[model samples]
Target: MTRTFRGRVSRLTAAALLGTTLLLPSSAGAAAPFPYQDPALPVATRVADLMSRMTLDEKLGQMTQAERGSVTAADLTAYRLGSVLSGGGSAPNPNTATGWADMYDGFQRAALATPLGIPMIYGVDAVHGHNNVVGATIFPHNIGLGATRDPVLVEQIGRAVAEEVSGTGVDWDFAPCLCVARNDRWGRTYESFGETPDIASSLTTIVTGLQGPALGGPASVLATAKHYLGDGGTTGGDDQGDTQLSEAELRAIHLPPFQAAIQRGVGSVMVSYSSWNGVKLHGHQYLVTGLLKGELGFSGFVVSDWNGIDQIDGQSGFTAAEVSAAVNAGVDMVMVPTAWKNFLTLLRAEVGNGHIPLSRIDDANRRILTKKFELGLFERPLTDRAWTPTVGGAAHRALARQAVAKSQVLLKNAGGVLPLARDNNKIFVAGKNADDIGHQSGGWTVSWQGGSGNLTPGTTILQGIRAAAGPTTTVTYNQRGTGIDGTYRAAIAVVGETPYAEGQGDRTGSMSLDRDDLRTIATLRKAGVPVIVVLVSGRPLDIAAELPGWNALLAAWLPGTEGGGVADVLFGVVPPTGKTPMTWGTSVTQQPINTGDGKTPLFPQGFGLTY
Candidate 1:
């Protein structure tokens, strides 16, 4: 499915393969040094040399990625795992940057203990700035970054994220989700850049930043061009649901981002859990193998989403057929998480039965091992702690602040109500998202389905507002708009969706503000004070009916850690420049509204009001 390869060195052919002039097994039964161990050798040559010496068990291990919690250090060596990963919220005991580094080193040591001594690659959902670690700098989600429409800034953020991830010894980042979010109701809409191939394609600059000028550069992490094709265009904005589209439509809307990503030398491509035309993507040979690999010439290894192969047969757990189908479909490495052992067994059985050819295994190994060699993992396997200090450091936070500021979309500023003067400004902040760090950070912060309260250390929007307000200004806050009046210059209501990742975040029903938000706005309106509504959400909420009652509206789409960016714009330190990445619909009825769509939008794509 990947490609045809050259002949391999069989165990019996080992002596015949290398010329007799080369060093042979000595009288002491010790062997000569391998070419694969030499750093000067080419990556393909090293991969070939290594593959020649590998057994079937070792080759299978190279194609498997196990979760950190499920696979112990001993298990790593026993299985000879090719990769280790910390799933969202799956962290080490201390959970600090150093703790992560120590954990990564421990696993590396176990992996090196194997006969082949192949160093395992570690991966994380560092989608938004080493999000699993507590103190790592958290950046705005993709939708927010898309609103900024600044690929250069996004690339800078990607570099910062790569550095932070490197500090934790995480060699791979499953990030820069290039999904062209077509529907507002999709829970992962925040993960997409915008509702077009062009926006997503432009943002693939992040892949370059993540991988550096080339693979193995300083702080360079293996970037993944994710959920491979047509994840964001699913019917009804479903999570892991069918995307019933003709091949042409899929290629036009969804394929371009991946094309752009591959051009940037993205190290891997993660297959989507969702299906296309009722055929699951994990098992879609035409798309994954034929289109992505053959047509597009994606030489990098293809990876499966978290247990994505299980859905190939529309079943709860994966079967041998699914395993063979996935491998035959060109999924080089599988993210088995907890079920890695079962997967290894099934894959071995499948390979033994000839369902998955040995050549496919070799191709998978060659692609994966080539990256490992290119990464210089064999030479520098340990965590590079030099970049450790930058995790959640001031510089990255400043960049995040700038990004957050740039991401602020001012949808409505009636009578120029924003740029609220800092000095002598009586700002009353209220609503659920005002002071909560977890709320501001949104999903994929410390956990998969990110939560509220102080889950990690970062500035909340209210904290940012107070700091910006300074000593001369008076700043008051409440969860609800209990105490606000015309006496205050403006009542800032920071209200929107709480944390939700995939399935739970999907809003099949009305996409309007919750009752709590509506009630809070009513309470603020009751005070007869100017209401400055700062909506902190992943996607645009249906707020046309409520827009008139508010004095001003700022779409602060899930600004992570550095909430001060929102404050910077609010107090005129930074002018609002973010444009709407997606069209804002008046009501839930206009569900799939976009730039070219026939339905009238409340705010068209790229629309933004600037003072």
Candidate 2:
């Protein structure tokens, strides 16, 4: 059952008892604007003063974020919303770097139309490079980077992501996912570093890389420590189901990375879509308020997940009253990709009726404004053209190539059979993802849940292999993993899961070898030829049941767009040094084992046998 808090402003003894100056920051003494003043300035005072002048409508606007094309500048003025975001697929018409910058400027043009003229902050996922825009250099997914275990390399990657993203006028990045993925069955596991807090903490080198010591420093892109608490530890390994854990378990396992990120001065945080126990995280006051805000001392604004506020009341329970409850529960901004007007209406009524205290509203607004100020948005409201050429230049792609090479974990290379003959006259490349750029890029690419076929500009493994082998080698492509003649010197099978996002791909157990996959592997193995199995998947599966028959194994972990990079290492141009970011279970039954386990994983974490 859900409870709703509804009361009018006039009868609120909560505010009355506090004082008429409820919204005012606490005085350190008498002249002090706040008990804990912003070292950056009495900027809190400026924010407080700004809040005093805003109407209920404007304050509601500050708590809302809309997509780029979903609404226009007119909508911003009409609703007085504070922030704007571009989801995975959302982009300008042409979808070029300059085109995206112009598109962003156009949206801000509308958002600043209000009486107070506050500029809207733009945000994007950019999980693997500035992936939304075409021609942007797509990097290896987090799971791949986790294997590198080089904090300095990860930090450089973060800086590269920021430089590219900021080139398009975007300031906020919802990245450095702190979730220690305890289960690979979760679809978003590839987004996480590993199943240990220490690994996740180390990968959070991006926090320092994104937000520099001062602000506006190179590679600084307003980092967000996301999906607060245990987003990766849901019941039955579901994406947004109940995460059953004691408070102690939650803190020990999940809270440390966020604390570490906070110490690095991460500029923002995004709330999780899952519930902690029985209550939706969006509506949970204890964690978002008492734990993150009060105890952890997070001054950054907490943004909601995509349409996460609606989950508060459940699918059938969305109502005006419930919307107000979520807002008061410590959600500063709502990612209302649609139906934003309803949020504004509910928030205005709640504020006027006194269900939400004015002080709470001020607090939320101040947090949002503080990030904007720290980003130096007030001084430089627009992006310069100087960074445009650097967006996806040759140097960036070189870094991408290095990332791809380092992230490919060679699981098995029996008898040094790999480093296959690139000079061979006949080479059989069979799999759906081998030549397909979209499949190579995986989720959050050109489209939200990454489409099939070549959606972006990049060379596929087929292309890369051909390039490396010169004109003499004949490469045959098969999407269905069939038509293996075995007449060739060798065969390369690139097979894995298709693209998916969040709850859509969430699964538990039963990651077995399919009949089709088994057939493909068997055909190549029986051909009296060497088979190089490049397994590209988000989660480590039950490969132990089927691996003894293979000549070589490579865990590519969703290598994006540049399947050619995989080709470079496959043919002996570069040695494979990448290790297993997560432990591979021998079977489905031996799941959830960490590094400290006495028993061995099929391949333990940091296990890489280089030849």
| Model 2 ranges with Cα > 4 A deviation | 1-42, 421-426, 470-487, 591-600
What are the lDDT scores of the predictions, listed in order?
A: 0.88, 0.76
What's model 2's lDDT at 201?
87
Q: Each candidate's TM vs. the true structure?
A: 0.95, 0.89
Error of 2 at 518 (Å): 2.7
TM-score of 1: 0.95
Compute the lDDT of residue 183 as modeled in candidate 2.
74
lDDT of 2 by residue, 133-167 (tens): 89898888888888778788888888788778877
Error of 2 at 401 (Å): 1.2
Q: What is the Cα-based TM-score of model 2? A: 0.89
lDDT, candidate 1, equals: 0.88
Off by over 4 Å in 1: 1-32
Please name the candidate that would achieve the greatest TM-score relative to the true structure: 1
Instruction: Encode model 1's per-residue lDDT on 248-315: one tens digit a residue.
Output: 99999999999999999999999999999989999989898899999999999999999999999996
